[model samples]
Target: MAWQTYDPTIEDAYRKQLIVDDRMCFVEVIDTAGQEEYATLRDQWVREGQGFILVYSIASRATFERLEVFRQAMLKVKRQKPVFMLVGNKRDKQYEREVSTAEGAAKAREFNCQFLETSAKTSENVEHLFKTLVRLLRATKQQEQGVQGPIRSPEKEKKGRKCIIM
Candidate 1:
C-alpha cells in the first residue's frame, strides 16, 4: 500500500480521483464546516465499499469537535460497510496541542475504530498510520467472512451455487 495526499483546494476533483486498493490512501484536507456535502460524499463512498480515515488536527479543539459531527454524518449513510480510522494529525506540535493523544484514542475507541497520531511535516508516524489502517481493513474483511464459509465471487454467484472458500 502506498500513501498519497489529497489536495484541499479542489474538492470534487480530488475526491473523484480517490481509489480503493489493498493499500492505504492518505487524504489531507481541512475540516468541513457543513455536513450536507460531506454526507453525500460519505454515502457515495459507502456505496462504493471504500474505507475512510477521518483526520483532525490535534492543535485545534474546533477541529476535534467537528470530527464528532463528521462521524455522525457518516453514520447517516450506515456504518457496517465502510470501515473508518480516526487520525489525530499534527502530532509533532505536541506543545500546541489542544487535544491529548489519550483523548483522541478514547474517542476512537468509543466509536469502534482505530486511532493514531501523525505528522505530515516531520513525517512522524505518517507511514505507520496508513499502514495500520490498511492492515486493519484487511483483517476486518477477513473476519467478516467467518471461520468456515464458502467464498463466492459476486459476479459468479448469479448463475448458480458457485462458491469457493479460501
Candidate 2:
C-alpha cells in the first residue's frame, strides 16, 4: 500500500479495485507529487478520472500553499469540475504539523471539496477518504443521469483515464 517514493520528479500511476457497498470500485491513483514537469500527463489523468483525492502533507507548508494552484489547474483543464476531496496526510506527525486543522478546513471550504485528515503511515481515515470519494462519484453520476441520462460527449472521450467501477 506504500507506493511513495523519495524522488519528486518520479510519478506513479496505480489502479486498485475495491468492493464498496457490494459493488466494484476501480480507483486510479496518479501521484503527481513534485511532477509539475509532467503537466501534459497529469492533465490527461485528470480528464479521465471520475473522482480525485488531492493530498498534501500537514507538515509541508509549500504543499498546502500549492493546493489551490493544483485545483485551479484541474478546473482549467476539465470542462466540468470533477468530484475531488482534500486530504491532509501525515496526521500522525503532530509534532511537525505546519498547517493547522482550521487552515486545512478553511482551504477545503474555499475549494468546495470534502476534507479529511489522515495518517497514511498509521492508516487513519484512509478507508474513509476513499469511501467518501466513491460516494461522491456515485452521486455525481446519478445527478448527471437525472439530467436526461448522462450528459456525455463521446468526442471528449478521446483520451482520458477510465475508472471501471462495476
lDDT of 2 at 66: 88
Candidate number of the best lDDT: 2
lDDT of each: 0.62, 0.75
- Name the lDDT of candidate 2: 0.75
- Candidate 1 regions off by >4 Å? 1-39, 79-81, 147-166
Candidate number achieving the greatest TM-score relative to the actual structure = 2
TM-score of 1: 0.67
Distance (Å) between predicted and true CA of 74, model 2?
0.6
Tell me the tens digit of each residue's lDDT in model 1 across 25-45: 433322333346565664665
Candidate 2 ranges with C-alpha deviation above 4 Å: 1-9, 150-166
lDDT of 2 by residue, 59-150 (tens): 99998998878887887887876887899999999999999999999988988888999986777887777777888887887788798774
Q: List TM-scores for all candidates, in order.
A: 0.67, 0.83
